[model samples]
Target: MSVQLLIAQLLLLILGLIGVATAAPEKILDHGGKALLALCVTFLAAQVRPRTYLKLAPYAWGVTLLLLVLTLFAGKGAAESGGVKRWLEFGPVRFQPSELAKLGLVLQLASFFSRRGVQNKLISVTAMILLTTGLVLLEPDLGTSVLTFGLGVVVMFAAGVRFSNIGGFLLALTLLALPLADRYLSAHPYILARVFGHLGRDEQVAVGLDQIGMAHRDLQLGGLWGQGPDAPRWTYFAAHTDLIVASVGFATGLLGVTMLLFAYWLIVSTALQVAQLATRVRPMRPEIHGASILASGAMFMIVGQALVNLAVAAGLFPVTGVPLPMVSYGFSSMLTMGLAMGIIHSAMREVYRAQPALADGL
Candidate 1:
């Protein structure tokens, strides 16, 4: 299973490099090098004791919070970022704290769920989600904000959080969002125009909408294989990052995107099977609930982000700034995903060692 995970990750990394090469040839070396470093971190994380993650969960979650707060106060923005505060700079390097928040929230949920005699679990968990999402939203990174919220939902679902609680909380959130969005969106017409433009209601956003319009044309040009016969044209904003899927599609066609989807499916399905096996391991099952949920939550962040990126590229949803998991050029994103998947690999390895039979198909 670890082997399969590695293969899938490598495939996606190669695809990311291809996307970069197609869109911004000069940056290929930079992204490819970061991808390699991330892959190393993935393998190293897989070798750690699975229980170590549980012990470190609190610290990891705390650090994530601290970094997110720091980002809001002094986060850096990329040339393509339009001054959105999504990164923290140190020396020559920049990192996205929001990336770590995804995994941190997962570990926090699993830790609370697997522990005993925790008071106000619901309130604390809800607060954690809202705070993390709120900070990212303040960065004006609606894409990452939504992605963070979705990651929380995935973790809670995997932890067997009650459906009524989930539903009621979401309902309350929607109520809170309407008025807040009304206030915020008016203050930030960039976001308001994006929403309106996406809905085809903003005639004032032609320049803004050009990105989406060009991406749509590029995707059509890709067809089944890509613009093979035509001079390959990749003229979309964020061509190597948020719009990497469209870039890859333009060069490699729908076949390329489908391959990416299939790779994600393989990884997620295998992880789910590991989680299922952890649930079924009889005497140890109760004790290892955290591990099971951890594995599930890990994939939720990795594969969930992948799906969101795909939806945005396919125009099935509004443009989300969420990059494809391992298939995008962000260094922090690659490293975060590498670490999450590696930790999940560690969990899966622990489970397989305990009940070897569970290792069969997975």
Candidate 2:
């Protein structure tokens, strides 16, 4: 196994066990079973051929587009009220189309930008990203839409798109968001509550802010050594998902949080190193360009989402439903992350396979 995969698995194992320990007895088996399943899926995904991805890149985008449209019409809300329709259910199995969209967008963007005449295709690429972002936003999932849009821009930038064009697009987006924020966010009580809380405006915000403050206190209560896995004070709403960093801090203290951050750093940095290596080999084969973009895009998504989740837990950002990658107790998230890691592993495999040829050329 690759070192990146090993580190990811180790992080997931540690966090999964922590989740199980903190969960109610009835839910313990559920958490454990899903974690095991995620591991199996991740392992199998890693074995896919890189060339297979190259061949399927176009079709992948089509499937994702279909899923996105299906989600708009048939997706279920995560909450009974005041939540957007973001999930598609099939009997006992439920999944998020947006998660799949994230991976699809990354792969599609990589394919789009890796080719020659990318400059001429700029308008089409921008339109594709905007359409995807618009679809995600229609789900009223602001966090994910922003993340998806950002990931596309990051891929474009990495592929050497002009900064001026990126700046113009972002400025236009910001202008458009202002009116929408006022019109829609004002009408959504729960969303308004979170936004108001961030802006220091509502009583509901106080509740969330207090939870964040309490999370900090919990960390302090744990100190350097933590209060232990079974500590009563570790409890909080969404403790196993959104606020898991705070839970870890409560259970394992500053030490555990530090270790978790270090693990994330290693994973992200390794991905970047792989991207850099792929770039050096780009001249030898066209596929290397796609691989480099894929590596960087995956790195951006994983690391960006992880940081956002951590920031929310730390009270640095207003709470959104963004879950910590690999560590959260959501099957959909686990599967998406697993797929991303698998693709990165495939890219890494290709890079290493080409190393001898690259060396001989030198």
TM-scores for all candidates: the values are 0.92, 0.91
Candidate 1: TM-score? 0.92
The C-alpha lDDT values of all candidates are 0.81, 0.76
lDDT of 2 by residue, 101-149 (tens): 8888888887777665356647778787888888888887888888889
How many times do residue backbones clash in model 1? 1
Collision count for each candidate, in order:
1, 0
Instruction: Report how far off residue 62 is in candidate 1 (Å).
Output: 0.8
Q: Which ten residues in a row have the lowest lDDT in candidate 2?
A: 19-28
Per residue, candidate 1 scores C-alpha lDDT tens digits across 92-190 of 988899999988888887777777422345787889899889988888788788888988887777778778778877898899889888787766667
**Candidate 2 at residue 77, lDDT?**
88
Q: List residue ranges in candidate 2 displaced over 4 A.
A: 23-25, 78-80, 175-181, 187-189, 357-362
Q: Poorest 10 consecutive residues of model 1 by lDDT? A: 113-122
Error of 2 at 357 (Å): 7.1
